[model samples]
Target: MPVRTAVPADLDALVALELRAFTGDRLSRAQYRRHLVSPHAAVLVADAADEGLLGSALVFFRKGSTLARLYSIATAPAARGRGIGADLLAAAEQAARRRGSRALRLEVRVDNAAAIGLYERAGYRRIGLYAGYYQDGADAWRYEKPLAVP
Candidate 1:
């Protein structure tokens, strides 16, 4: 699957993908619109012409910080187990590095074993946790991976 930086044309499809992959705390259409043009964000999508939109990732970077945060990542139900998530994650990391980020970070709900396992296998180490990080009072495990050797 080909993953590319998302453009305005992908807004609706991206929003739909987010809804399909997540239950709550999903990104809004407006948020997706803004992030598409935001200088601080890298919005990437897996676009397979025949399949339409497959997945998306919203990774953020601070102006003066070397740390890049993966705000969100989601793959459509039909695309799961096909490694689309890993492809999006790799693309996001490359984008962050191009933007001068040395490390990437993300927070996943503690109960999401699949996601947690994916992160671990990708070389991301759990470094901390946020109590009640989700709107539903679910805790989150924070993980980080260095894009460049420190």
Candidate 2:
């Protein structure tokens, strides 16, 4: 369950996890490659020696902005309920903080109770809602957490 910044070598596993974890709004292989080197983005992955990649969290930051966006987070089907999501989340927050972000924001599918619970348990507050936010027209709940300065 070691979580680390994703590298180019992790591209394949990252894409695989993305495909296995979500049915829609999936990140393409090219996007994963781009994010791996993007100065404004951080792709963090949780991997094990035998399990390959357990999960990944993608975060985006903007110049001069104190807020970072948790663009996506996915845990492999076989790795769910193992706290991998939470671990990836904590790693994402840390990545954002390292970029000088004072707050982190994310949008989760309204029907995804497990994700909502994870965010809530991590101290993220429901800020608002976005209508028809997903590819399948599912609404999303906006959540935000203020990161304490370290």
Candidate 3:
């Protein structure tokens, strides 16, 4: 899978992947449109030559802050278990570094073992927890990873 910055043309595929991959707390089409053009955020997608979009990762950077937030990441069901999520994550980290962020933080549903494993394998450490963080009333575990300054 090749990862690159998302463009307006990717809107439909991105929205479809988000809808198929997540059941709640999903990003709206308008939000995705805004992020695709926002200077404070990076929307990245992993594309397959034949399959369109395989996954997407959204990261947000705040002015004067070294920490970047990995707001959301999702892989299409058909692309799961093939490392698409990891590829998007690595790309998100690089996107953050390019914007001068030194660390990346994210929140994952406590029940999402796959996502938790992906983050942990990528070197993110659990720092805290948020109760009732999801629309479905599930708790979220906060994780962070310090990016190496290049």
Candidate 4:
């Protein structure tokens, strides 16, 4: 899989994929559009050979900070279990490192075992918990990992 910064052409597919990937608290189409051009955010898309988009990862690089947030990551249903998530994650970490981020952070639903496992396998460690973080009143586990400076 080839991971690259998302362009405006990827908007519709990204929006549609996220709608199916998350049951609630999904990013809006407008947000995706902004991310494509936002200086503080990096939106990456994973594409397969002749298959278009397989997943999208959004990371935020806070100004004047060494921390980058792995704001959102969504893989298409047909592309799950194919290592797309891991690839996207590694790509995010590398992108963050290039931008001077020393660490990457994210929040995941406490009940999402698979996602937690993926993050952990990628070296993210749980650092905190946010109560009722999601719109549907679900708690979130905060995780962070040190990024190797590029």
Task: Give the best candidate by lDDT.
Answer: 2
Clashing pairs in 3: none
TM-score of each candidate?
Answer: 0.97, 0.99, 0.98, 0.97
Candidate 1 accuracy as TM-score: 0.97
Ten residues in sequence with the least summed lDDT for candidate 4:
47-56
Position 69, candidate 4: lDDT: 97
Residue lDDT tens for model 2, 1-150: 789999999999998898899999999999999999999999999989887899999999999899999999999998899999999999999999888899999999999999999999999999999999999999999999999868
C-alpha lDDT (0 to 100) for residue 37 of candidate 3: 95
Off by over 4 Å in 1: none
lDDT against true structure, model 3:
0.94
lDDT of each: 0.93, 0.95, 0.94, 0.93
- Superposing all C-alpha atoms, what RMSD in Å does each candidate have to the true structure? 1.4, 0.6, 0.6, 0.9
When sorted by lDDT, best at the front, the candidate numbers are: 2, 3, 1, 4
RMSD of 3: 0.6
Q: Write the per-residue lDDT of candidate 1 for residues 1-150, one digit (tens) a residue.
A: 799999999998998898899999999999999999999999999999999999999999998999999999899999899999899998989998898899999999999998998899999999999999999999999999999732
